[model samples]
Target: MSVRRLRNLLLVLIATVTLILYGCSDEDPTSTSSAGFAGLGQDVDGFQDAGSNSSLTFPADHSAHPDYRIEWWYLTANLEDESGEPLGLQWTLFRQALMAPSKRPEPTPWAADQLWMAHMALSQGEQHQVAERFGRSHSQAQLNTTQNSQAGVVANPFHAWLDDWQLKANDEADNRDFDNLTLTAYSGEGDTRFGYSLTLTAEGPLVLHGNGGFSQKAANGQGSMYYSQPFWQIEGDVTLNGETKTVSGRGWLDREWSSQLLDARQSGWDWFSIHLEDGHKLMAFRLRGGGDDTDQAQGADYRSGTWITPEGQATSLANSDITLTPQATSAVAGRDVPTRWRLEVPSAGLDMTIEAPHANRWMTTSVPYWEGEVVVTDHASGEPLGEGYLEMTGY
Candidate 1:
């Protein structure tokens, strides 16, 4: 099928999935938290606007948040095949708080107020494969534990998991490194199937974003708590396109959670996470909004990123230094999407062209958008710079 046609198909799939999701929840909207905080946003109670917060804590903070409305475990990797061909892969799990803990459906054995969604995709030049899944769990059931849910993080043994996807260490010794860790993710059916089982070593310490994991998303202080382990040492096998090839590449893991993720005026965002040639990693994102038109007195385009050096230090990329311009638009998931973009970070002395390996990597979930692996090249020199992932939403 053509790219545009495939995009349309994906869109229909996503829309159908969303309608099914709405039908699954027959709860009375009035019985929930408050007005305006409809849908999954209702799970949070008394949510104040985002503001400068104190530094975050480890182990405890890295775990799940039942009170919050939404959270996610997002991972993306830029890999190479046995023949040295570049490939991009992404695995993400999102949790949406459905109802407040105070309002339980019943003491019934099977009840739930938590919604879970997962997305997995593979990207190669002009070709893409994407899949999405959704499930619901009750706080009163075995699905969610008071100490920890089915999805959680524990420091001692160093384990993080949700459903079938997981990353855990083999040894529990304090001195033992997370290097001997196993990561598994699988989905799809028959000829359209894809999955991965890999081992990851911590090549470096975890890097925090925006002054130690408090990423500011909007001028009004609505943003997500975010962090990344961008320096993973990864090697293993991934089954794709009817073949399982042993692959090795640097992987990046990002963890983010928040009650109010976006501002009312914001529509979506364009985000990039890249590993450069000279031992550096860059994460940049643009938030779409009605900026200058607002009384907040800030511009509509908001962008920020973390540039990490091989030596394990991070520098912030400000708005003025970065640029994202759409080169062309392609239909994805029934929407016209800018699948190609020109990205430049002047302060880092980098100018690159960002293009998807394929244009059909759109997740058909409760909330859908275009997200996939992308190729980066030096704009001036026309040299292949590196591989990374790009996500564009609400367009």
Candidate 2:
């Protein structure tokens, strides 16, 4: 079958999965807090923990690891609309192994041992449009060629997808890094239509988070296999509110997974990937309720970051090297969410306050949360620094 045809089929599958998701939930949105706060942390029994010594390989590692309990392919962009207005967009596909590898279900027609979910959003000005989908598939289905599974990922021709929403290889680049990608996704109808068709070109090598991609999430040794392609130049067409515009800008893509990432007491986190005008980028995050009691950690949160230079040099920031403080809050989706913050990385000489242009950029997905583009300015001089994306959860 042709790639285009396969995507069309997946699109239909996505609609079916979306309707199914909406039918299952009428309660609160399941934010990241759902795992961190609501006491809904996944039971980690047979699944394997991401080890510190695990090596990350290309192409193969880009595909699904059915043994991990959870993993996600995430992309975020800070773009400019045709009219020069700033717009932000996000696309993410999550895979959750419902059963351990040892107990994985057979590839029977209706047997499923994995759950797939995808979240897509577009934010511009005060408007944000979001959609979420859910699907089920057997772990071995990805290996079969005859039947089309609900969702799966392949590495050689590098493609990660859920239904029709996907980030896939669009060129014949022999590079196993999967750096040349075309991202396509859409949802909603009428004036609420939203999605983007973008092409991303990698500008730098993939960046490993924390200690060579074993990103510790808590005070304890718990962590996830984390890495990112922090350098992408994006150009595409974004459709919103039934209008289409051509945009070009910078983008970031993150790939991570873990059996159990955060400790039960940890609340949520504030994650930032800022692109500075001065040939630098900063990636930082803080998880609440640090498991200090066991890890003998000193802080109340788990903080770590990477300061990436223009030439792709990465310096991992320890807890003492980074500080994040909320400066203001805005009521979004009936929750008072932090929309302003002071981000300090003294060693890097960064003391800036980031602020979201508007407080309404809330993703009302099945797992509602706040994510949007923000402007960075020097804390003291208030001079423009640059622009980037900010994601806050569990607030």
Candidate 3:
């Protein structure tokens, strides 16, 4: 690499690390008291907040929202190799504004107003390989053919990238911009290398959460604009430990953004996205605290979800409509993380036990969390129901 390019990359890394380690969350990464999990509930005095009336526009919405304090393009896949062994992977690009719109620094070649972080993980059996990258960019930076920013996103053709890791529209597809996409990301070298190059074709329409697209995260009405493309037919090659295998299965892509996504009293959350064998899909979450009822000691947990049909129809599940209970825990990274859960949606005639086949799916990044594939079964008969991914944070 040229000297100037190397220097620029170093500067971006330094800026991202400094912001995440010092300014973003609590001084103590482990503390959820002052700032909600990962500082998501921290003050948003100047940033734009997500509201019930906010409208979601396609193509445009697929790109970054610089006005929002935090946003991410997150995709998770559950696949099987040629031999049918289950494998799972996740690729997420997160963007956090360094300053509110009015407070942004002047746009310059070396100035950045956004800190970008991307995380990639591949897990199978007991093996879990993870990688993370950081970059910086100015929200107002112009796009040109000569050179692209270290990390950024574009709407028309739908491209989200950081360095060489990218998730973008598939030029060969005949479907809508986001309906057909391609993802490529790799890390490490030689024997340690792992990642995937996959094509994702949407089998169903995008499903929005909460009212329209306003997903309420707390009883105080704080929330984010959330939606998902949960029916993706994924096919491609996955490499692990330098060995490549043909894989094909389903994937889920989630889009959410907000300036203040949680209530100050909210600590962490347990989120699940499931695809049943019977053609139904479910998305549910439980925010540990931050609710209206103060009579309870630790405050009531805020719960919400979406019950999606095969045809793309959706039914919103309110707090009273869902139940998420931690059935079992495991020692992971010095913390007791819930690896088994009972998720019930009586309204949808669903009572299933979700358990992680592996408990070591910890992302040891700047801000760590537990994320991995899960098996779903009949709560009473133990009959196989389906498969999905589980993410537990602030444990």
Candidate 4:
């Protein structure tokens, strides 16, 4: 095999083993040995923990946190073609540290200290296409540019990539780093080709979740540093099934990192990102099985969220401030996955029904899950309220 091909195979093997052992909340929820859902609630003895006192800085905080065990750059878009048909797409790059910062191996071409995986999916109606790739890198190695590593992120230029699949700053100017960005990734070929080349421009300031970026995930205080760019105007071309179309719509990009992100008893989570018609945005999630003493015995769930106004104002929503109930389920991939839900926020005077128009949007990657675009409507009148995305894991 060619040297490059051989290296790629080796990296894939390493990444596969790392993901299997370390566990990813959305990737491997079936792991029996994991401390929490997909090992996110596992103990972090040597890794860095996300604390409430730590402050988040721009450009610098945008880069990788090698001291943490897990991190991800995730983006989801709700788009439409000129004909008005809707399409949803997702691009995520996940990083897993093979060892703690103190235990990293010496920087060498053959030694790797980190495992990287990238997942991209495109869904339209019943047609859902997905692809995954893996790569490896030495955290200690100098990654001044994209060519220095197979997969890595640079904070200054705001580039996160794995192979040709990349999300980077559209402008080289420092001030425009995260505000104006570009995303490009494609997989398959011939009749099965699929991917997107899109420009994402931020419409609002970045919103921090929970206690100023310290997003609490459970009652036990386990959590991660979470923030998002939820107001994005996206425009570009998307190629699916070997046919390309001009598309434009709204997008949301999420950034999170942590060593332990869940409580030991939590088994899974249902997450939502919504963009209302009135220019409001909402981010909510429920971690199943991590409640308090009485609640834990009854298998209760912990919920948290952020309510955002169009002008970039944010309000943190606590467990008692919101309610999410799975109103219906669909048999997908041999699993009973919730495809319809009732979301309520009394403070915002919102009572809405969220449903996935398409139930076949199951990602068939190494670690499978259900993710798709959802439509929101007023529960009382059934009037269309907005649209967004839903992600359900550990079904």
Candidates' C-alpha lDDT: 0.68, 0.80, 0.88, 0.88
Candidate 2 achieves a global lDDT of 0.80
- Per-residue lDDT over 88-189 for candidate 2, one digit per residue giving the tens place of the 0 to 100 score: 999999887766888876677657787788999888887788898776678787665433687888776777777788888877666644789999999988
Candidate 1 residue-wise lDDT, 1-395, digit = tens: 89656644654554456445532344432232221112332223654223357466665555556566667778788888899987777877776656666665874433556666677776666667777655555544432333244344444455656667776765643444344567788777776678888877778777888866778775655567788888887789988877788888988888887777655445568888888878888899987752334543543667788888988798877666678788888887678988778888888887888877578878665566778877788877779888788888665
Which ten-residue region of model 1 has the weakest summed lDDT?
A: 29-38
- TM-score, cand. 3: 0.94
Query: Model 1: clashing residue pairs?
Result: 11-333, 50-221, 112-138, 291-300
Candidate 3: C-alpha lDDT: 0.88
Rate residue 101 of model 3 by lDDT.
Answer: 93
The superposed Cα distance between candidate 2 and the true structure at residue 39, in angstroms, equals 6.1
- Going through the candidates in the order shown, the clash numbers are 4, 2, 0, 0
Write down the RMSD of all candidates, one decimal each. Answer: 7.3, 5.3, 2.5, 2.5
Better of 1 and 2 by TM-score: 2
Candidate 4: Cα lDDT at 52: 90
Runs in model 2 deviating more than 4 A are: 1-35, 38-43, 144-147, 172-177, 291-299
The candidates, ranked best first by lDDT, are 3, 4, 2, 1
TM-score of each: 0.80, 0.88, 0.94, 0.95
Runs in model 1 lying further than 4 Å from the true structure: 1-50, 104-108, 125-127, 138-156, 171-180, 290-299
| Residue 328 of model 4, lDDT score | 95
What value does the lDDT take at residue 261 in candidate 1? Answer: 65
Q: lDDT tens digits, residues 119-211, model 3?
A: 999999999999998888898852432228888888767788989999988999775489889999999999999999999999899999999
Collision pairs in model 3? none
The deviation in Å at residue 23 for candidate 4 is 3.7
